[model samples]
Target: MGANFISLSLTFAYLAQSFLFDTQVYPDVVQYQLAIEGQNHTIHLEKNRDLIGKDFTETHYTKDGKRVTTSTHE
Candidate 1:
């Protein structure tokens, strides 16, 4: 019974630790713009490092979502 109690306590501790420090490694795009002229344009973005220390992605999509471009500055 003591062993079972210890195991349950360890389980709860592990669960608690997992919940406490969980964070998303994947950064998202914080800013974007779009202009669709009689076509379907969908832009999906992710993170790229900036010199001014702002967190935003350099990825861009154009030509009816058929092209992908990356830039140092948007």
Candidate 2:
């Protein structure tokens, strides 16, 4: 029973460390905004130049009484 408890604790610790420090599992996201013809557009993507001007999906949200717009690459 003691050995099993120790193994379970180690497994949990490994999972916690992976969740806290693994960058690939939680990639960095950047937000960009563009304005054209008096209209505003917002997108969320990685900081890569090659990804610009690609197809994406737009999402809208409301937080703290303000509308938020975000986009994800398709």
Candidate 3:
């Protein structure tokens, strides 16, 4: 019984350590569609980007066919 308890304790400790550490889960970027109604704004949850920290909402419409994006804020 003691041997089984020690083994269980060790397994629990290992699992606890693994959960506490910062495992690098793949970083991600998400795009959101902003809906504005007469100065009121509502943010919507969109899809995730394949590349981490990528800007998915870059402006594509312009008089000269130009697209630009500012700094990303979380």
Query: In terms of lDDT, which candidate is strongest?
Result: 2
Every candidate's lDDT: 0.43, 0.50, 0.40
lDDT of 1 by residue, 1-74 (tens): 33322111111212446556857443344223343443444455545555344343455677688666554345
Q: Could you tell me which 10 consecutive residues in candidate 2 have the lowest summed lDDT?
A: 4-13
Off by over 4 Å in 2: 1-27, 47-74
Cα RMSD to native, each candidate? 21.5, 20.5, 20.9
Model 1 pairs in collision: none
The count of backbone overlaps in candidate 2 is 0
Per-residue lDDT of 36-71 in model 3, one digit per residue for the tens?
332433333333555556444544557887776554
Order of models, best lDDT first: 2, 1, 3
Who is ahead in TM-score, 1 or 2?
2
| TM-score leader | 2
lDDT by residue (tens digit), candidate 2, 1-74:
33321111111223556668787644455445656455666666654556646566565657667666555553
